[model samples]
Target: MKPLLRLVEEIRHGIPSHYHVDLENRLAIAWGERKRKRFDIKPRSRGENLVATRENRARIIYLQAQDEDCLLFLAFILAYSPRSCVDFKTTEFVEFHDYALDNIQQRASPETEKLLKTMAIRRGFNQNLHYLNYMQTMFPKGIREQEPIGETLVSTAAESVGNEMRIDEIGRDDRGRQIERMYSNGPISQVSMFGELLSNAIQSSHQWRKERGLGESTTNCWTTMIPRDPNEDISITIWLGRRDGHRVNTALMVEPTWSSPSLPMPE
Candidate 1:
């Protein structure tokens, strides 16, 4: 029998790095990369001379995944299942199955309904749908920077500064000291200002800046707020962006029409 990953493309898309498959949960994920810290000089531990060495720092980060279509389709398949299934026992599966069946009964479409009726009775779920990779391709390429989803506050900066924002505390790779990051979003504008004039302008824009569209969020929205580092010099601002899918491994596809829009979306 084909394994779950071979049966479901979403499960295969992220098997190596993004996530693991779950015959029960449909997917299992744990994402918090560990961080390390080091020091130049080591000091005494108990009033005696000690070797100078670096210290390791461990960091915990939160994560969220988006793969609704895969789950929904699975639910639709499992709805008509005669035997119990651990991989697809979610309430969504049962509900979507009924929804599809109801649509069939109503004769939503003569030929289409007939085909769905046949699929509904299939005991095995064997669709190679690459949901994640396809969604990644749909994302706009104009965006180039990404941050974690959250609310952020900043004052309006000068136009010249905004074009070339001087953001200090830029985060850098501790190991290579390259690839800078943000401690916070840049506070800048297209208008140029300096000294008190610039300060006053920023303060005036503070209200709007503080309350900018930092509201509710969606998985498709670019919401990853990259953290900033302390003791870093000012650097030019960068376009915010995101990688729709992790490219740790090449996507193995089962069908070309895996994530086709023509497919029905069972709620």
Candidate 2:
């Protein structure tokens, strides 16, 4: 039998009778058909040092039981790993399964858990790298700069310095140390003034889609903001479409698509 089919069967057997499967979306939804009952399933402690180290590591696993997608299992695992230090190799699915089993059995050694976490983190980072590389290919060069406005600010400041200010003399003092003085008639603003200017610039550039046409149809519009500092720049992208699905569209506003290896960062 196919792996997905096998998984579905196992899930059907393992899950409580209160849950129903949404075959169209391949999602399982839990319902309150049965009287409320709570099982005494003791929570397992991973241990202090282990948990602390796990927190510091970059591997992560994000799972949503509400989603019928099989990839949710993998997503859950990746969400738990530390940031920036783990790798998951796509070709090594067997290794991933083994590690997952070990993790569930509580038989995973500290070292083994650490290694698995590292692999998961690396996997996520590599996936992001691949996505960024693809985007780089799609977008031509010079479409955007790392710090567009920052470069402008620095260049403007440098150009204005000599032309706007004068350094007339440098003379030796009584102790033979050189003395220098400069004068400027250029405009200077307090930090708050600069901040206000930046805020206004961003607000002005923001775009909002206004309703057009009749019926129950609506769309969204987007705008770009220019930052005063190169490092502080930001851009917002929006997708607008009619919503026709039941599941919560936490990430994508449209219908849920197939699980891709490179998921976009959560907003």
Candidate 3:
């Protein structure tokens, strides 16, 4: 197996040239920002690519960059404010709104584990080991576990290429414009085949637009397997899109979540 450092290097190389910042750059910047008291990375704004690395920067390159590597961002968040991660996808507390949501669901990320542990010790959370045990069960299911159950070794998009193509049809309005849906998840792993396909799709979309002499394509979409029934335990990720014409909002959740995961009932 290749070393972890090699993996990061390769994955970073795979990042589309459009991206302003990649994971490694963000971590280095976040670490430096710690020395100053004020939160330098502005928590808000709409950007297509990452911004240049600088303290007190208005944009978090990672938020708009890609979906994976949120672990580093959260790791920094943990160092600064651990509880904010509990609301991983839905924290309006910061100006960067949904910045944390970019690549959530990365529980087992090594960066997350390492920094979280270090932050715990630094913050004195490790004074008692029990707290670490408690921290493990927080939100996303796969953070600390070394299992790849949540990751896919194959590309669902590639696997489906040339297969029967079916688009979810929706009734049109009086104007006869086609209604579109949006879907995708982040915290996508650099090592996973599924993520690679998504990355390819994004890159392809950019080219597709340039070929047509068009600007960015508004048809941002993503898919996941999901269960067909409430009673059955079987699950498949169904493709879902954002209702609003904006990017995924951490304030809301992916479609058909219907209801948020019931947080543990009050004690």
Better-scoring candidate (lDDT), 1 or 2: 2
Model 2, 189-256: lDDT tens digits are 22123244332332222111111211112111222222333554344322222231122244335754
Task: Tell me model 1's lDDT, rounded to 2 decimals.
Answer: 0.23
lDDT of 3 by residue, 1-267 (tens): 123223333332233232223333333333322223335586433231222312224223223222222322333322332222233443232433233234232234443444444443344333221222223222122222223222331211111112111112221211233223212222223213435433444433321222123232222223322222344332222122222212333333444423323233322
Off by over 4 Å in 2: 1-8, 12-47, 55-58, 61-232, 235-267
lDDT of 1 by residue, 34-131 (tens): 22233448734642221111100000000111222322233222222212222232333222322222222211123322222222123111111121
At residue 28, candidate 2 shows an lDDT of 11
**TM-score of structure candidate 3:** 0.20
Which runs of model 3 end up more than 4 angstroms from their true locations? 1-72, 80-94, 97-221, 226-267
Say which candidate scores most in TM-score.
3
- Arrange candidates, best lDDT first: 3, 2, 1
TM match of model 1 to true structure = 0.18
What 10-residue stretch in candidate 3 is worst by lDDT?
157-166
Q: What shift in Å separates residue 113 of candidate 2 from its native position after superposition?
A: 29
TM-score of 2: 0.18
